[model samples]
Target: MKRLLLIGVLGLALGGCATPKYNYQAVSQNISKPAIGSVNEAYVGDKMLTQGVFMEREAYYVPEAKKKFLLNIPKGYYLKTGEDQKGSYYQPVNAIPDGAAFVGVQSVLITRDNSFCFVDVYFNKVCNFKNIGEKRKISVANDNSFQQTLIYSGKVGSKINVGYREFSSNLARPAFNNDVEYDLNESKTIGYKGALLEVIDANNQSITYKVLRNFNKVD
Candidate 1:
């Protein structure tokens, strides 16, 4: 009994040292046909490794020992829809947005490897990925970041969000660019050199900002 109590106390002490986490919200979605020869390969790793991650903002990291990733989120209670107080797949249990409909959120856990072992996130009816878009392998790993692989920010247009899958049953290749449901500034997004890649929704909108690299310092 004494040993158990000691272990419990240690656990509580260690938990206090851990940083408080943040919530990351998925951007809205939009669709765009890339210019005939444009290829974009960007990821969160570049910024994440350097800036670390913001608690309460959705972010993930691949554990050093494993190639998998960890999704930083609290376990949402099992609920019928986002509006239902019991639980929601559309929003958090404590907070609910109006007009959102989702079944329930299944809790996904991660190990020391920091990788997500289960691709079964899709199986959960409460997931926001109901419109299962295309799957693209983001080179979130260090080796790829060293090579300056482009990571999309998932923002397609000014008011739209284009999201993708990180965990899948099949492994994908690097440098392979897939069709995006939205433009660069719409859905998946990352920031470089204090300038954010703004999602340009109109033909008149320009994406002429330079995405400078500062990963060498972090590397």
Candidate 2:
């Protein structure tokens, strides 16, 4: 009897350990596309590497090294390095002499071959790229940050309050949060950020609505 009990417990433990597959369909049905080009290639350290753009800056990836580097500095800007009790720190400089180390900002070393390496002050390493864990691989879905979520806060009188949160791929801009109130008597259809929603029914506790359109699918 004890053996049977132990086997049952072990089975339950294994079942609990099993990870369920993520349902992308439950989250969204809209097609996700890559923000960067498919065959973007750039040269870094004499090695041709795949390139990507993030936060309006050029990014390079080293597949074998499993690393990502961002060109955080802009053209015509020089790199400035300083040292203190904290060791080394770097920043971008707007003005410098013609040959006075006019390398991009955030870059620690610009090699004789014109290759660049960024500074990792935490690790005390110079020209080091961002380390993406060995298990993590880059993908379009992961890169797409556009997310829109709507929540119904409650209702006051005849007005219904709805809140919206959005994270768009426009890295240069900030995330958007909005709260809107609509009167049930005015219209059942609601429009937000090019997407439309229809109120089926609602109360102070909860709201029932259907997505007439998804902003992601909007052109």
TM per candidate comes to 0.18, 0.34
Write one digit per residue (lDDT tens) for candidate 2, span 1-219.
553353354331111111111221212224322221122111111111112222222122222322233223332323223333322222333222232232322333333333333433222223333232111112222255455555567777778787666545633223467777889899987766665667677677666665555454423
- Across residues 26-84, which tens digit of lDDT does each residue of candidate 1 receive? 33221122222243333422211122111121223221222112222232221112112
Worst 10-residue lDDT window for candidate 2 reads 12-21
The C-alpha stretches of model 2 lying farther than 4 A from their native spots are 1-144, 168-175
Model 1 whole-model lDDT (C-alpha atoms): 0.26
Cα displacement (Å) at residue 124, model 2: 31
